[model samples]
Target: MRVEYINPFVEAAYNILREVMHGEIKRGELYLKSTSMPVLGVAAIIGLAGDVQGRVLVDMTKDTAIKVASTMLEGMEMEPLTHLNDMGKATITELANMITGQAVTKLHNLGFKFDLTPPAIFTGDNMEIADTGVEALIVPMILEHGKIEINVAIRERN
Candidate 1:
């Protein structure tokens, strides 16, 4: 919940997205939510435990996921995806891993130690997420493909 904890993820997301997408990336205003919030369509969630405990969500519309995945694949000289197939899902998962891995490294350098669970991808409509006692801070990143919302809901463990 501290600003210090959130900045790394925001910076990592921006850097990773810009590097992978090779396009203009803009960050939207950050906001907090204490109640359930709607999921855009596709989300990759990773759990953190140790010094901090909670989760991080990379949320985006299915369309955005597909486009982002396609862009990533194309960068590797692979065919772009037209749907969220297994490969597409894996690509998005890897993207989540990259962002969180970088952020965790930064956090570690700042003296916080934690373990991250593998990211799980969720896709559906009319979905909502509620973190019992933690308020989620969301940073929305806009790319030419679409927008990605990086939702962080971590608190220092007592």
Candidate 2:
């Protein structure tokens, strides 16, 4: 894994988690996982092109996701958030899109230009959302606030 390839993600995550998620993330950490998830949660995937060729996935459980989503929507429960529902999917997808959008600008500022495909939302407990042929660098970010965790996965283009 390349540090150059990964640092931007950390930068982006910290910014988004702080600015949008109502999360006060620390310096933040990144990880790679080859294991299968018990559930897919909400996967907001933005395809990559140009300087960086990879997809970024912001995934989370329904409950944890609702908490973050509601927080983003001004600290109110969504009223009817259920497992993998459309509301949950939209919430997570938008969050991922916002992060990626900011990342694009940051990358541009740093002298790299990358284009993103539209963010896609997937909802399922047992579905797999991996780019079959791309090498992935999973960046699992953790947020703390009376016990909450938010994980993000990023993989370069296939």
Which number leads on lDDT?
1
Tell me how far the alpha carbon of residue 120 in candidate 2 is from the true structure, in angstroms, after superposition: 1.1
Off by over 4 Å in 1: none
Candidate 2 backbone collisions, by pair: 53-157, 54-156, 54-157
Model 1 alpha-carbon miss at residue 151, Å: 0.4
Lowest summed lDDT over 10 consecutive residues: which window, candidate 1? 1-10
Clashes of 1: 0
Candidate 1 C-alpha lDDT tens digits along 14-132: 99998899779999999999999999999999999988899999999999999999999999999999899999999999999999999999999998898999899999999999999
Clashes of 2: 3
Local distance difference test, candidate 2 = 0.62
- Supply candidate 1's per-residue lDDT for 46: 95
CA-lDDT, candidates in order: 0.93, 0.62
| Global fold similarity of model 2 (TM-score) | 0.73
